[model samples]
Target chain A: MRTALRLLGGQRFLVAPLCLLGAVIVFAASAPEFLTLGNVSNVGAQMWVLALLAVGQMFAIVTRGFDISVGAVAALSSTIAAHAVNALGPAGLLAGPLTGLLCGTLTGFLIGFLRLQPIVATLGMMIGVRGLALLVTGDGQVVPLHDADLASWLAFDPAFGLPPADWGAIGCILLAGALLGRAVLGRRLVMLGSNPDAAHLVGIDTARTQLRAYQLCGGFAGLAGVLVLLRAGTGLPTDGAGMELQSIAAALIGGTALSGGVARVFPVVLGAAFIQAVLTGLDLQGVSPFIAQIVVGLVIVAAGFLEFALRRFQGFAFHRRSWT
Target chain B: MTALALPLPVRSAWRRWRPGAAAWTTLGVFLLFAVLVPRFASSGNLVNVLRVAAILCVAACGQAIVLVLGGIEFSFGSSAALASVVGVLAVPWLGPAGGLAAGGAVVIAIGALNGALIAGFGLPPFVVTLGMLMAAAGAAASLVGGQPIDAPPSAAFAWPAAGSVATIPVPILLGAAAVTVLHALLSRSRLGRLWYLAGANPVAARLSGIAVGRVTFLGYLVAGAFCAVTAVVLTSRVGSGQPNLAPNLPFESIAACAIGGIPLAGGEGRAHQVVCGVLVIAMMNNAVVLLNFPIAAQQLVMAVVIIGAVLLQNAGSLPVMLRRALTRRPNA
Candidate 1:
């Protein structure tokens, strides 16, 4: 009974898995069309951008930092990709993702190397980068990608009849999970998140580890940019607004601690999918996207609260006592 | 108090430097900005910078108080927006001061809601205040009917923005006057010191018989009042109460605080430093605009500076942090 109570009381870092389950159930139960092949693929397609952002946010969140600039970077990447797609046709295929990766990497460098708080550093990036994205694109208009053959092959085509981007996202998830979970680099990254000071005491190079995690995160976001551009046939400067918030929400839900030290990247993917599912369900039910945004905000706050509450009940505080 | 148990250098330095570090950092940032930005040190530009920093300072200084107690007023954004709009809508009926008071009252009521949810019900500050952030934003929208409001022009409202004091912007004067009062409240009053005591360590404060709850309530109340002051300044500056005067305020104010060395971590930091942080940000913005740096380049620079400032500030502690991070046990 004590064990059960304790289990009940603690916030299990299963937010990602649970959110995935909840999203699937809620969408499948409420919207009959949601379970259909086209719709699930649609979900998958929508998730392409979010997944990349999830990886980006995962690194920052795990390090007890935030990269709110992910959204901004996404916009800039999308804008850049849009222009690159127009300029290079099929050959410019790699440009979009590369732009995003570079943007994410550069921003990450500032945060990790300069030691700025993730949120502020990213906030500045968020405001300034978006403007740059707009400036580059000449406005909010998306530059259409003319390479239908390439777009279909790279974005929509499926190796096993699944959307190509879905497979790509899966690849991303696996790669990220392997990097975070199994690699020596991954272990060091986790250690960096756990406690920079303590990691330093034992000769772990905190800065380099952090920089690598950020680099990986940026790369993932870049891939997400490619997927988004391919699917939409165009990229808008506003493509990734508020994406960082969603990614953070998904990561926190997926069971990653906001205070760093523990991470589970696969769970983060599910969390993202779950959140998208819930939003899709709400959209089917005639709820406005704005309302869904509010719902997403609520979910994040709830997830944060749960983590805080669960940690409290177990008599093992992972981080400082936050307003759970 | 735990430090009291320790002898010599540790306790005294903690009491002295920790309290004033934020202020020194703020000054340093201001000086840096004034030197770095072209025309940053110019008298005309300096006044403009001060004017820009003043309204935020009014809001942030109060935020500093609440943060000291570990309570965050995310509601400041919505409340300021709401106050500005409601005051505008009420001006025709209630006169200027009355309109201001009416807006102030609404803010206080909303703050009351926040206080009740947190203190009375024991809801976490994050949840309670986040809820307020949403609810207040919605309320502001409803009050304005999703449209901009046209406020009746009044000197009482305009005094803050008018560059009336012999080339010195009135907003700067207004901000200075407000800061004078806030500084006094924070430094001179027993209540203020007690507030810091409560923030530095709540359990210790409680053990010492301080009314922790009351302090928290008042701290939030003060936050609301300060938000009202900012609302007044902002609305008057635009000569109307635009519902979206500062949708990004919570982020901006917090960033200013972080950059100024008055992070939300609480206890330490001071108002004098807060003004400097605000000036630094304003100057940076002015410089970016003046230099005509492409937005991206400015972003890169801004990002670098922010991260650099934080790293520089904590460089001495890096070695200690590294040691701690390594020794912390892995998930067994």
Candidate 2:
């Protein structure tokens, strides 16, 4: 048991996977249908939007900052995509991400160049973007897609055992993983986050790194918006009001250090998946959705406690080993 | 000796003039609205604005305390919503006054919980408060099956919101009292000094024999008490329990504090700043409505003002690169 504890505590990214496994076990035992193919596919289909958002949030959090504006930006992108699709056909899908990139750039400018606090900058962006979305949709009305057939096909029709939208999400996640693991910008972001003073001393352009982080975050939010648009078959201006909190919770639970610098794309995705599973499992059990929300909230706090415990145990174990 | 003496008077004069940017902004916004928006200067409309500002002021005062501790409280909005729900539910059994007390206790309890988690565990304030926010909101929602619960209308129930003492609304009186008390606590009390010290530098404060954790815990508790007052008044006014009551309370309060020149980095704020910030926001909202703009326009304007206000406030501290970028000539 001691060795097991040490092994588990030794790995930085293992917490999310462990939590996911525990959730799967408990949910599978309580709700027999949780592990079934149909429900699994349902969760698979539903999780991409959140997954995309969580991954984007990870970028900001890894940089020792976070973007709360992603949800609002996604809504704005969704509305923009709806209008673009109506006017320009299938080519308009690209507009969603482009719009997101623009919003992200503005947010990045505010945080990086203007030196505004991340929370303040993102909060301002959130309000402005929500307003922009409302303006686009005219009084927060949902904008129905003209190409319903295409949307449904992309959203629902399975190719390679997954819908096109899910495939797209997977592709984006892979790209994000590659970017974080391989790219020079990613290294700069991590270095900056770990120690801004040292990064500056090392000649890294800190402002530009922050700018790129927020840009990547916003771009991911835009991709999530595209997914939302495809899934809902409409542009919803007010759809993603609470998603920012969920993404933050997911990123945190996925072992993305709130203190910044440490993170992984796959673990964060598992974290999102765990949340989605809980939500889905509760729904299947006829439990109130609000109860699920409470559980999620508890899980978030529990994740914090778990992190704390692991840190303490690891320290103790190291001390004992060195003394012996 | 003359130069030093001259500088003393100049510094004092600057201090006297320094209600700071937020105060000036309030005056400017009020005057602009009075001139531009028809009927905005009318006494009745002005009273309405004050009435709205009163509730926000009380909440923002609590928010200011938390900000002064270098902590953020996102759960205020949801906790207020939960309080209203719990308050209304208890009214049938506990009566109006008793129900209100129960609701206030619930908020205080939540504040204590947040305080314990943050101070005891060394968890981030953002994480703990956010978690509590979700939990409290869920509790409120689940309690009523996601619907509003009406409290039986009574004179006693409405007294806190509607009743007047000396021809002044209770909310306005309460708002004034909150500001005055906050001012006293921040400037005159020993606990207030400790809060400031802890917020500014926790490690140094600890080394200096201050109980930093206890101070932080109390700051959150005091903030919660302030939010409770606002919740009670709001519930009294609505005469119902709402799951979605004041969802923007946290955001609006933070904005108000920021606009008032209370830096989020903490350890400095004043009661007058909270009042001035609340007044500016209230006036802007009132003016937007009076001007017949779309709801979207109101949000857009608010966003612009919030960002612009912060930007303007921090202009003096802008980086050399940014200052150069701003001043660089097109030809050059």
Best by lDDT: 2
By TM-score, who's the top model here?
A: 2
Q: Tell me the tens digit of each residue's lDDT in model 1 across B1-332.
A: 88675777877788766634445555676677667767767877776777788878887777777777766667778777788788888888998778877777877777776766565544456556655665566567666666787877778867766747886677777778767877888889887888788778777898999987887777777777777777777777787766666777776676666666765656766777667666666667677777788766665566555555555556676776556444534531
What's the TM-score of each model vs. the native? 0.78, 0.94
Clashes of 1: 23
Q: Which residues of candidate 2, in runs, are more than 4 Å off?
A: A1-10, A316-324, B1-14, B317-332
Per-model DockQ:
0.18, 0.40
| Off by more than 4 A, model 1 | A1-11, A14-41, A83-113, A131-135, A138-141, A157-161, A312-324, B1-45, B66-75, B82-170, B194-218, B239-243, B287-332
Model 2 misses residue B316 by how many Å?
3.0
For residue B103, model 2's alpha carbon misses the true position, in angstroms, by 1.0
| Per-residue accuracy of model 1 over A22-65 as CA lDDT, tens digit each | 77777788778878987777777787678778876787667766
Kindly state the number of residue pairs that clash in model 2. 0
Model 2 lDDT, full chain set: 0.88
lDDT of 2 by residue, A1-324 (tens): 668655544465677888889988988999888899999999889989999999999999988888889999999999999999999998999999999999999999888888777877898899889989989988999999999999999999999899888999999999998898898887888887778888888877787788889999999999999999999999999989889999999998888877778788988999899889888988999999999989988888888787667677667442110000
